[model samples]
Target: MVGEDIDFTRLAVILCKPDAVERNLVDGVLERIAAAGVSVSARTDVVAEPWQVHVAYRDTLTDPGRAPADRPAYLEAAFVGRPVVVALAHGGPDIHARLRRLIGHTDPAQAVTGTIRGDLGSDSIAAATAERRLVRNLVHTSDDPAAARRDLATWFGAGRPAPVCDFENISVVLCKPDAVERGLADDVLERIAAAGATVTNRQQVTVQQWQINVHYWDLLVDADWFPGRDIPACLEAEYAGRQVVVALAHGAPGIHSRLRDLLGHFDPPHAAPGTIRGDLGTDSLTAASAEKRLVRNLVHTSDDPDSARRDFGTWYGARRSGLLAPLLPAQIAPADA
Candidate 1:
């Protein structure tokens, strides 16, 4: 059944992840919100600086009963973790309350089943079960209308200016050889734009199996199966040293999740139908041979600036001669050719 209609003053959700947000799950939330006929007033992707985290969790810091040593570690853990913020403004009564209900609470146990956290979260340390809730939880919504109002003020300027622009940060997109070979580059880019992300730097790359083996080196060395699932095929000759595309997309709210969802997992066939995988994937599960089966997913989405820099170094830094010139020196810039 449809629920109460709430006009949000403005709300910001903190979405944290290991690397990238999952496709079908996050897309479902966006689709549900859109189906409800709500329009987003503003959106941005925020990487919580140390001070910001300290401020957000200020109340937790001084709980007198808590150990001082533990408090610092807790603060550090939450601060450095990769997070994305999705902020919005609405024009109806009880909007703040409604959004609070729509998205679940930060604590895993308290999150409502129908919300993003309930459905997608697993253990912050590990994905024990598809249904397991994490200490990280899937997402965070403001606690109450008052807190929502206050948070909007801090994170998004409380609607002083429009909310959906690209000034806050940037995106790094990896359009693998599969996309270029299948002629779906433009379609993928269009989906990214439709989702509100801007493309800042785009390039083509020719990568070797050994390079992928190195980039995913941790996976290669792991004796466990889950971590090693994609390594072997990544080494196959048919997939060796192929040309791929790379893009640095400017960050905005909604765009990051949208692009990853649209790109699907590394191998397209496993991706859901509405996604890029369903639309363009050539290798299906039933393929007769390894060459016939598509590798993991099509695109790569960076979790944060640090990850972007690290992965870009493994993939693009070794390839690009002078790209990303304006990036700050201390900002963990990607290595250059």
Candidate 2:
């Protein structure tokens, strides 16, 4: 199940609570995946918006004459104070085995010790919420292909590998100080161009914990792994003072990988020397398992057409973005304008 034989099953590696609390736990699972030699196709950090959760779980509350309106307060209580991190990845070929091994590392009854949840967790929800604290649980993977496709589209986009000539993608990149410090941005851009990717927008925005949480919104359920404790305070602290670089590139299928390969993870220390990270990265944190260290292991791509359109709309404000735009748009625009 290696290479192209296996379908590119998209997995949403969700992180909820302990912006830092669960860092080690989640990092370990990712390390295990890397150990299996499974390459991570794409990754991103998104904070879960309460509204999005409300919609995703709307069905649960609206069953059999249940009114969703009645659940607003509950939604507010559950999400008002907390935010979650979402790590997105595409996996295939022995990933399940690797993931199972990681899960098995935790304390079975009490968070499955040795796993992300067990080692990092404490009073559960008490730390996250004064009334409650939660332990850090690492990663969330999408189950099955259909769910994978759906989840990928919801988070990454339509998963298209080709370019929409009329529209360009807004590639959001973070050139951590390490990249700039090492002066690798030029080479990174050159690589992106070589891979058929073009930059349409770019920015050097500092990352706030809340932004990370909002970006990774698909996580953050008050479930078994997350005891729904002191989440707000943790988020407040993580987001208070942080800086990150952002870029928006548009072009073709392999652009995201190009940048990822160049940036390495977090800084210059950890990246492969010839590659972008190799030349500029400066972190000891191993690459997310199988892949080499490059960037913070946090570059994102639109998983599908729908997702691309939605994300583009959010980032670049394309008025008519979607698969059905051809039919829905009042007038057809030139495909390659």
Candidate 3:
């Protein structure tokens, strides 16, 4: 049954090697891969385990092919104990071949000018051979359906990845319309990372009315608080076709409130100096009220665990369940508790 469930030709496992992580090219590489029409998702960061890499490079480790006798050591030095990014790429039946071609040759020097390795890779076969090491090619993709099947088992723990749900440790970042419009999403994310959060899966979504309606359902329900403003109309006018950036932030427990505090006040003018909105935002609630629109607060973060889960669905799409990490023990108490 597990074999029956595999997408075979349509699915490939992507391994952004330690060098990619060290150089912070995971996002850029993944973006290029995704740009090639493959659906990239289930992104995860893992410290390379010897066995995992052994299984992944079984061909070289066992047979070496044209590789030198020191090839296994080179592979180990490049991957073991270092961090790498893993993801799933979904496409047509020829996805494996497509991705293989897209990544280019094993040696960056020999890779074609238009390919991923050719463009982004700096290390070469000659350099690696001289150093008695493997070339730092940046990424790896399954060779074909059969390889994809083995890779699924090898890297993804038999199709289930290692990221646990970790609600208390995760929060959703919603860079509101204003943030994207003003080109401040990157700055906002940078600040979040600086504050020691692991932010991933940054996505751009063109707001749908239904999504905004549900996201701010409370505003609609409590419209009377702002007697003159029409909540529904405000939501539609502000968000309905606008673009926003969404991301997942992972950290220690209490990440939700920590992020909320980091965002400062909902009304930028009232926020503290170091907070995200306080430092970057120009618009305020008073201005919005006068203009009959929603306050351009720059960003919104989930208020709690349940809110995070809902916000994940609202922005990232509910059906992409593979992206969520596994859940930790339910009996464990929150850190503050």
Candidate 4:
């Protein structure tokens, strides 16, 4: 929006406010947006500044009809110094409207069911007004193309330098829904950590169709392997709406292959006693074959460096660029005058 002419109809700026970061809802929130056909990217973590917030709310902050009567005083108190996550959501021209509906009413209490604010928000406008504060709604999207341009400037700031997307020493570990439902996520991650790799940033994700599709792209490509089953339907039935745990495993180069070996064969029966599947998994290929379903492996690790990047994006959401902070090379700051 700043350097190039952006197609506002196809792009919207998403601001996950401080409340979202504090409540740890940014990942799940972005996942829901993506599930609705929007593609989120370039998620940048930023600390809110008073001037930025003032600029972002220039049109409304001073209006009592839209904001608290004491907005000038409370706005900064609510946002300044707090961490916020911003990203670009790309979709059809209607994306702004769709996202607004998805996020629901400005007041969480008035927000109807099924919308993001309705389902996830807890604060109410009435309560905020009574307390002389701003409502703690979880997110905000550009009102229109004009606002998109301003939001892009206010939130995203200068484009982040391209991130170091290396994966030779990193792997994404997905504890499948089975493991989560069976209460084995901790056990599975512990095993990976026990294997001498550092495990961190563990997050729980509500399955979205796009995520399953992308992560299992090969399955869709080679659907011939499963006869008499609608691959998409089977995938939705198996994963959509289910919760899974994902984490990062870091070590020396080739950590991806090491983790895959640690996870063992997909079939529990075929996995050796020392492997994660052999030791903890309960489902088997034999049962799945007979039942016309896929095997329920307890966990999956990236197959290679490339797959690690794919897996990371699939489970973590594109807006979670901060998760790669550790993997990024330190910026060399110029000496002060």
RMSD of each: 19.2, 20.2, 5.8, 8.3
- Candidates' C-alpha lDDT: 0.52, 0.43, 0.82, 0.80
Candidate order (lDDT): 3, 4, 1, 2
Worst 10 residues of 1 by lDDT: 1-10
What's the TM for model 1? 0.39
What is the full ranking by TM-score, best candidate first? 3, 4, 1, 2
Better model by lDDT: candidate 1 vs candidate 4: 4
Stretches of candidate 1 above 4 Å error? 1-168, 223-233, 236-239, 253-256, 265-270, 285-296, 318-322, 325-337
Q: Candidate 3 lDDT, tens digit per residue, 19-100?
A: 8899999999999998787767667788888899888998887774665677678878888999999887766788888999
Off by over 4 Å in 2: 1-29, 55-83, 93-101, 104-109, 123-138, 157-337
Winning model by lDDT? 3
lDDT of 1 by residue, 213-315 (tens): 6555665577254442344664554356787776666554444565667667655567788777777776654452344333545567765555565666766
Alpha carbon RMSD to native, model 2: 20.2
lDDT of 4 by residue, 1-337 (tens): 1424356666678899999999999998988887786766556798999999999988787676866567778889889999999877766778888999999999999999999999999899899888888899999998987887678767755443324546887799999899999999989988898999876666778998899999999999999988876778778888999999888887789787788788888889999889999998788888987877778988999998889888888887775544554222121112231
Worst 10 residues of 2 by lDDT: 323-332
lDDT per residue as tens, model 2, 278-299: 6544444444222322224323
